[model samples]
Structure formats: structure tokens, C-alpha cells
Target: MKPLERLGEAKTPDGTVLQLYRHDGAYLIRADGVELMSTRRHLSEDKLAEVACAPLVTKPKARVLIGGLGLGFTLREALRHLGPDAEVVVAELVAEVIQWNANPEYALSAEAMADPRVRIVHEDVSKVLRNNVGGFHAIMLDTDNGPEGMIMKENSRLYATRGIAATMAALKPEGTIAYWSVGDDPGFVRALENAGLEVKAMKVRAHATSGPFHTLYIAS
Candidate 1:
């Protein structure tokens, strides 16, 4: 096997180390020694957009907000599922990640980024949710590992009761929010319910019908 080569690096707003690596034709983004995302395994990430935007297919002028742009799988799938009138807003905390996508060396989501329906925002997603009231038909969050995990400590608020309320307020009537987690989070489920969302939890494989399973929470 070939060794992983470090291609670039950046620092999160909170000073966390974000490194980009390439191995065997695949790209990886890691933070503090933990893999944040990999080009080789993103089935669940694509599923996040598929399940969330499934209902929006018929909804005209559908607008969606994607909290994280890891590898752009979610955004790419979202574009595939929605119509020409639809719009996708991707909020990414790290600017370097966006740059990585645009860099031909990585060849990750550059075309997706150029799609007319897509908009890029280099800011925290929570702020976007708080500021845009009833603006989105669907919201997909794959920012960190899960509700309890933290790539950035501030992201925790997005899963808390208050944050969930903000997210709910940001959605249009019957609009859905999907959260991608490494595993099930019962407490987070309860929090979503307490915030008055109708919730459904699904167990999805890391790859299509194989690999470890991850959890995707869909709430309306």
C-alpha cells in the first residue's frame, strides 16, 4: 500500500488542527489525529441528503441548508435530488476545506461547488440557522461525529434544546432536519422531541450494505 501524503493543513477558528492527506487516490481530512472525513467512505453522508430532500422533490423553489461540507457528498446528492428551481446553501466552518474541494489536486466537489443552485458560506451553521428564519425546506448537519462528539466545542449548542429550537424556527412548515452521527444518541433524540419535532432515527451502513453502521436522525 502507498503511504498517506500530507497535502495541506489549516486551523479552525478555535485553533484546532485540520490536516488534509492523500492515500491511494483518496483524500482525507483529519482533525487532531482523528479522521473527520474520507473520500473512500461517504455513503452515509450521501444518504443524509437523500433522505432529507426526498420530500422536497415536488416542492417548488425548495431551499436547503447543509451545515457541513465534508467532501461535498451531501451537497452533490442534494443537487441530484432537487429540481432546477431548488437552491442549496452549504455552510462550512473551515475555509480550507472549501479550498480543498476547489483544488484540482483533490478533485472533490469542485463541480458541485460550481453548480448554479449551490451557495457557499464560510461561517458557523448555527448562526446561519439563527439568522434565517423559516428559510429552508431541509437542513442537513454532518458537522462533527455526532451530537455528543465535538470537533469544535461550540457545535454542541447546535444539538442542545435551545439550538434545536433555533433550528426548528429556521425551517419552513413541515420542513425536515437530518443529523448524521457515528452512533445512536437517545438523549439527542429526546431533545429533538422536547423541541417539538417529529423524529425518526435510522441505522445506516458506513458503505452501501456493509461496514460499520451509523445513525441518521430525521426530524420535522
Candidate 2:
């Protein structure tokens, strides 16, 4: 087996340590000392886009906002599901995460990033959500480990009442927003409802049909 290689490191806006590592030909990202995401287990990430865009796939000129580039699995999946005229805007907090996906040696999301329909923005996703009003047909968020397990302390706001309200305003009428979490968060679900969006919680496996399960909060 190949030993894990440290690809690079970056700091979040709040100065939290974010590191990238490669092991067994797969990539992983860690915040502080906790493993945040890995290339080997991205099925749920793909599902995030698929489930959110299912209703909008036939809509003409559908537009989607993806929070957190991660390895671009969600972005790539969104591109595949939407039509050629569709647009995908990805807001990544850390620029290094975007660079890692563009790295050819990694072959993670190089092609996805180059797609004409896709746009990359180096900014906090919460700001993107707050600034846009009815701009997107769908929004997918996987920026942190739910509302409670925040990699960056500031991210807590995104899952709070005000943040949920901001996201609700950013979406078109009946637009869907899907949030990926490492575990179930009932309080966040209630917050989404209080924000005036219907919500459903789903349990998705970390790897297709195996591994631990993760929660997905789909709201509209």
C-alpha cells in the first residue's frame, strides 16, 4: 500500500487548519484533526445534487448553487443531471480545495471545473446565500458536518434560524435545498420548517450500500 502523502494545507477564514492528504490513490480533506471528506466516499455527495435537481431537471435554464466544492463530486453530478443551458455556481471557502480539484495529478474534478456551465467563486457560502434573492432553482450545501459539528465556528450561522431564512430567500418559489450532514439533526430540520420550507430527512450510506450512514436534509 502506498503511504499517505500530504498534498497541501490552508487556513479557513477563521484560521482553522485545513489539510489535504492522499492515500491509496484517494484524496481526503481534514479540518483541524477530524477527517471532513474523502474521495472514496462521495456517493451521498452525488445524491445531494441528484435529489435536489430531480424536480428541476426539466425546467428550462435551470440554475443551481452548490456550497462547498469539496472534491467536486456534487458539482459534477449536478452538471450531469441538468441540461446544457443549466448553470452551476460553486462557492468554496478555501481556495486550496478548489485548486486540489483542479490538480491534474489528482484527476478529481479538473473537467468539471472547466465546464462552461460551471462557475467557481472563492467566498463563504453563507454570504452567497444571503446576497442572492430567488436566484437559484436549487441549492445544495455540504459546507460543514451539519449545524452542530462545524469545522469553522462561523459556519454555525448557516444552520441557524437566520441562515435558514437567508437560504429560503435565495431560492426561487418551490426551489429545493439539500444539506449533507454526518448525522441527523432534528433541530435544524425544525428550523428549516420554521423558515417556511417543507423538510424531509434521509439516511444515506457513506459508500453506496455499505459503510456508516449520513443524513441529508432535503427542504423546499
Q: Which lDDT values do the candidates have, in the order given?
A: 0.90, 0.89
The lDDT, on a scale of 0 to 1, for candidate 1 is 0.90
Ten contiguous residues minimizing lDDT sum, candidate 1: 148-157
| Candidate 2 structure quality by residue, lDDT tens digits, 1-220 | 6898999999987999999999988889999979998889988898999899877778899999999999889999999899889999999988899899998888599999999999999999988988888999999999878787787887888888888888889999878899999888788877888887888898888898678898999997
lDDT of 2 at 108: 90
**TM-score for all models, in order of appearance:** 0.97, 0.97
After superposition, the stretches of candidate 1 with alpha carbons farther than 4 Å from their true spots are: none
Q: What TM-score would candidate 2 get against the native? A: 0.97
Q: Which one wins on lDDT?
A: 1
- Cα RMSD of all models vs. native, in order, equals 1.0, 1.0
Sequence-dependent TM-score of model 1: 0.97
